[model samples]
Target: MLTKRIIPCLDIKNGRTVKGVNFVDLRDAGDPVVLAKQYAELGADELVFLDIAATLENRKTMHKMVLQVAEQVNIPFTVGGGISSVEDVDALLHCGADKVSINSSAVKRPDLINELSDKFGSQCIVVAIDAKQVEGEWLVHLAGGTIPTKINLFDWAIEVEQRGAGEILFTSMDHDGTKAGFANQALAKLSDIVNIPIIASGGAGTIQHFSDTFIEGKADAALAASVFHFGEIPIAELKKELKQQEIPVRI
Candidate 1:
């Protein structure tokens, strides 16, 4: 069995790490560099740094900050937001990002996924899909979950995989920051739909939620923000408990 991954997300805005509920009402968490180092040393499997406002503000990810944070940790780092072309991914990788995540850009031009995976290889490309359920359909959202689309979440996931995306990061707008748990049902369905790994995001409040997402949701990884940012759950302890539960995790 593959070892499930625990990832801490750094949602950056104005050069500071921030967190919000349902993708609104942002608050400062801490310095990205400091938090990055702490999470790496604390046993996080990977780190994701997203410039949450870069797409909205129409700018590239802060390469200077990516370089700074990249210098502090030895783990694989993924950078996202305002990344639309092959040039942007190249720039971030040169700044030490092992992987690059694309969202709005991919949705706008689906061919971007093919171009990126072709240039950088599928292992380094992650497609982030932020969607929320509307009545009965889960529609994809963009611009930091501020805009909704008619695109079905499942359909997009399948298309991205077919385009050569290595993984998919799915964030549930409704479950985000609610701490209730992850969208396991949707995740399970996604896992069945795609052969690529799925990283479940949103609604992680307790350790049990992690286990549930991995087991029931069939997720290969679980990513969280506020819980780890606020020290509400320590990475080491969470991994220890997951291991005790017979979940495959690297200690």
Candidate 2:
């Protein structure tokens, strides 16, 4: 079986790491480079650095910060936010991002997924869908979860896959920062619908949540922020516990 991955997400703003609940009321987490190194040393299988305000601010990802963070970690890392064109993708990848995640821009121009995948190869492209459950249907959100769209989450995931996205990083806006658990139901449904790897984000609070996301949610990877950011759960401890529970993870 393919080993499931544990990833730590660093939501970046102004060169610092920040995270918010339901994508609002942001609070400082720490310096991005510092956190990246810490997570890498803690056995994080991968790391995600999202320039949470890049799109809203109408600027590109902080490439200087990305290069600094990239220097500290050995694991594969992904960078997202304010990425709209192949030039943007090329810039980030040149700065050492193994993959570039596109969200708002991808929704606005679905062909961007195709363009990126074609240029960088599918393995270098990730489509991040920030979604919220409304009236029983998951709706896509953009610009750091502040804008809503008509695109349904499941449908979007399928489209992204067909367009050649190597992975889908699905974040439940409703469950983000809740720390209750992952949106496993939606994750499982996505896993069944898409052929590419599915990464579940949001609502990760406990070790059991990690196991559930992999086993029950049927996710190939689970990404979290605050819980891992605040030292509420150590990556080493979480992996050990997950292994005990029979979840295949790099130890």
Query: Number of the top candidate by TM-score?
Result: 1
Model 1 residue pairs with clashes: none
lDDT of 1 by residue, 58-141 (tens): 344388788887787888989998888898899899888899999999999999999999999999999999999998899999
Question: What's model 1's overall lDDT?
Answer: 0.89
| lDDT at residue 41 of model 2 (Cα atoms) | 77
Q: Which lDDT values do the candidates have, in the order given? A: 0.89, 0.86
Q: Which candidate leads in lDDT? A: 1
In candidate 1 the C-alpha lDDT for residue 197 amounts to 97
Worst 10-residue lDDT window for candidate 1 reads: 20-29
| lDDT per residue as tens, model 2, 137-187 | 999998778898989999999999999999999999988879889999999
Off by over 4 Å in 1: 20-29, 55-61
Clashing pairs in 2: none
